[model samples]
Target: MKLLLDENLSWRMVNKLGVVFPEVVHVTSLNISQPASDISIWDFAKKNGYTIVSKDDDFEKIVLLRKAPPKLLFLKTYNLNTEKLVNLIIANNIKIKEFINSDENDIFEIFGE
Candidate 1:
């Protein structure tokens, strides 16, 4: 599945993660300017079928409160470092796939080691 990285993620992380996530795009990559509103981004993803990968808790609310698609990878980890985040994604990718396929919606929160 593809990952649409949020504005919170550095654009460099997309390149750095390489094959970990098949396709990862930052908001800037989409040519959207900075300070894009949460709802707008979510709306874009919903309309376009891009599952979100973000550090923001707002997506969780969107999932729980709004039940939007495709689902969300909510990085709650505090490290906020590139390598750490990449490792978490690599480790949890299988679970992520299950989330995308199963009937239930998911919230994947990475706790920093």
Candidate 2:
């Protein structure tokens, strides 16, 4: 599954995650206007078949109201650097993939253990 990473995440993650998630992209790369709104990102994800991966709970709220198609991965880990964040994702890769494939859930939350 492709990930449309939110602006909250470092754009550097795009390349770092590229090997594992080739289609992963950051909001900055999309040429979205500065301070892109959550709605706009949601629209882009809905149109592009990209799941929104973010630290923002707003997207989670959106998923709760809108239902599927633009799924969400909500990273709830605390005070992690970009590398640590990426590592966390790698560690939970299997769960993320399973969540993407499942039809029952729209939002997947990842927390540091």
lDDT of 2 by residue, 9-106 (tens): 99999888887888999998886776899999999999999989999999988999998889999999877999999999888888988998899889
lDDT of candidate 1 over 1-113, digit per residue (tens): 77788888877778766576666777776745567777878887778777888888877887888885857888888765787888788888888777766766556666665
Per-candidate TM equals 0.86, 0.94
lDDT of each: 0.76, 0.90
What are the clashing pairs of model 1? none
- Displacement of the residue 75 alpha carbon in candidate 2, Å: 0.3
Candidate 1 stretches with Cα past 4 Å from truth are: none
Q: Candidate 2: where is the Cα deviation over 4 Å?
A: none
